[model samples]
Target: MDTPILRNNFKSEEYQINMGPQHPATHGVLRLLLTIDGEIIKKVEPDLGYIHRSIEKMCERDSYQQIVHLTDRMDYLSSHINNEAVCLTVENALQLEVPERVKVIRTIIAELTRIASHTLWWGVMGMDVGALTTYFYGFRDRELINDIFEETCGARLTMNYNIPGGLMFDIHPNFVNRTKEFIAHFKTKLPEYDLLLSGNIIFQKRMQGIGILSKEDAISYGASGPVGRASGYSCDVRIHHPYSNYDNVKFNEILKTEGDTLARYQVRILEMWESLSIIEQLIDNIPEGDFFAKTNVVIKLPAGEYYQKVETARGELGVYINSTGTKNPYRMKFRSPGFSNLSLLNHIAVGGKIGDLVATMATLDLVIPDIDR
Candidate 1:
């Protein structure tokens, strides 16, 4: 066959397009400046700070107890875990040992937060890839967890349950039973998630070998949670640090050798099961004692720097506090997982297609507020 050439000369140059700041696929107010050659992406530069609220700076002015609420806005999905990280940091600095009951409660809530977060991610990830039904299913499971949080902590998304010493209050009476029921209900539904999305032939092909991020690059970029674990990086804070009651619980850290989008997706799916198992271990034998440890009205940390890390739904959330013997911190910084994970976006997305870039971003689960903070 003879090929007919175009009469007009077309200058071949990569065209730049903006993906967000308002696009829904972005999942937040994140703007991605993408340079594309047709459908293939050549570069991805994330323009953040759209939702920046000066959270770190706000912590400097707020009291240690008040500072906990500011973290709620950072990774709102993992707000409970975010609050715990700050509480743990202050507790560690003051050398205050939280009661056994508080530790167990914190652990349970943290796992619930993880599961809630993953469910939402799974739903949105599917929708981002053109699978719409998965969104409803993901939210269906997530709402149950939200109900549990609402009853227990009185807030769904930004539950400021954790305090400097322990929890704000004891767990609700329905907390244990509701969690068990949700777990049992979700177990059957969880398999449906795999059947609907994970097992789809088209999805597998779209994700399996695309946006490949190697283990070394994952470590270098400081990718954590499912993102790092998908690349076979053993960066699980629970397994390594064992904060709160994580040391007592037995659950496998889900790891996948393949560093593709499919591997990242699979890691989070498997992690939901592991999170359920973790909750099951601690749900029954919650120690009977004070839910919060005794602390003074005004908590003043000694002049020193203190750091504490906890595994949120996204990854390792490290809270660093520099106190100058005052109720308010002299300086504060959060090592947010989303920000670190997002740093590797351009690296993995350079040679992939626009659709592949979407899949990769879905798996990365880059929460914008966390990044901007």
Candidate 2:
């Protein structure tokens, strides 16, 4: 289906409005220029880098382990995945072997992070569309996940828990039991989310036909995760590339043909359930072994480059490190998926109503820090 898009807005010369750089809807420090006629958006141009700190460039001056803290700030919601990505890449550099138990533990933590992140997005999206009470439900549920994380890693948001060989520590003895209990309650709570927000008639009317990105457009713009899945593209790195025993599991790649904000919401909702299923299977079968690989505290790299891709809350994040047999890296580059996902904003929101623009942006879940970095 052809999406509603701006046509000759420049020739028509519509009124322009600045949507953000200060608004709550931009997530963090995002600016959207909206060209409007009455309430409909004639065009939207996103201005970023308000939060850029040259994090990738800073990595070259620090040791390999020091870079983990920098990744924590990129997508503050999914810190575990970021830490895992950096550790996996460095491990690949040294050709280290990880134990089965370590792999299972890492997988469990990643899923917990996904649930917390999605819960936040769900409530925030509902609020953006005018339902404020749903936000409380999301945060309440997220607190549980946060508690779990805090007990495991000693930090809630910016955990640099993964080392090059293994994890920061073994999963707590109480961790598995607590996880199972949480999963049961979470399963009960999922239906309440659908009743509260997903099936709301007003939300459907607002989201159904707005901000559509066709499959080809999504692929051409390099969208990933829920955005691409909403457009019928199966582009999940966890499924396609199979990192950290994702290959040994059975799961579906959620996709939709509608390519609108609703499609994105549904994709995320279904993914939460899939993540739960993955965790349940692995928690009981966690093998008994070392948490980390054996390596010296002071790390050095050979004369080569190491690249790693890990699925984050947003999309595929890549860490590329080049070393010339030195303690410090020669070059470091971070490929952030939110940057390209946010780039698609102008194309998708140009012809939509002003109210829909907020909903559309929320569905995309733009992490401005990730984009700027």
Measured with C-alpha atoms, the lDDT of residue 280 in candidate 2 is: 86
Please write out the lDDT profile of model 2 over residues 225-250, one tens digit for every residue: 99999999989999889888787778
Using all chains and alpha carbons, the TM-scores for the candidates as numbered come to 0.97, 0.95
**Clashing residue pairs, candidate 2?**
165-293, 166-292, 166-293
156-232: candidate 1 lDDT, tens digit per residue:
99999999999998899999999999999999999999999999998898888988999999999999999999999
Assess candidate 1 and give its lDDT: 0.93
Worst 10 residues of 1 by lDDT: 1-10
Candidate 2 yields a Cα-based lDDT of 0.87
Provide the lDDT at 308 for model 1.
92
